[model samples]
Target: MADPIDPSGLGRLLSETMSALGQFGGGPQDDVVPPEGVGEAADGMVRAAVAPPGRVTALALDPRVMRMASESLAEEITRAVNGALADLQEKAAGAVPGQVDLGGLGDQLRRIQEDAGRQLTKFTDSLIEAQDRLARQGGK
Candidate 1:
């Protein structure tokens, strides 16, 4: 009988490789359910519900807010929305399980690439220097 393919093993290997390359984390995180964010303004007279990805899923405005000037209402709404989006971002960052922090990884990867380029440049320069010396000796 032919050996069965171990798809899970292959998936794990790929996931590990991507993670090592500072790409993403592995495994399903549905269990770590994300929490919704709420932003309130004017003593909760205006509220915004923000879901994942900074989406405003809903907005609630108290009837009292209607009595305020139009400009004031607009400002309150804007403030609520901004607060909700910021809250959502924080929640989303904390929601994922086994999530890799890319903040430092990006800088680390850039430094590695820069170091590699410098080494390559040095190697090329050495090779050229050797060749030039050899050419001068051969001419003599």
Candidate 2:
């Protein structure tokens, strides 16, 4: 026998689907920028702050660092930039959902689809049975 249609279950599934999709849509967080990631090198003589999309928002050099040889200064700068980029990458990774989250969402959607299909099939079967009963009564 087919399962009975459940309006409450269907409503709950639709709500869940909307909630999941809302995570990927624009919201209050859309207007807010993530905090910049700061990194330092050479005993804090060089510092860099990186923003999202790996943009360098700021770079600072201690006065003492200016006296270093050009090659050494460049190396310090490279180290600071790399550290800043690494920090930014870590933060961004934490902010985004991983593969497991996406996979779970896919599974949820599939279950909703299956549930809806089952409900529709049940409703159709019920309607057909009622029509058949009505036809037999009219033929008598």
> Which candidate tops TM-score?
2
lDDT of model 1, residue 56: 88
lDDT values, one for every candidate: 0.75, 0.82
> Backbone collision count in every prediction?
0, 0
Q: List the residue pairs that clash in candidate 2.
A: none
Give the per-residue lDDT digits (tens) of candidate 1, residues 1-140.
22333435445544544565745544446665667888999999999988876678999999999999999999999999999888888887776557576876676666666655555566567677779889999999
Clashing pairs in 1: none
Error of 1 at 69 (Å): 0.7
TM-scores of all predicted structures: 0.50, 0.58
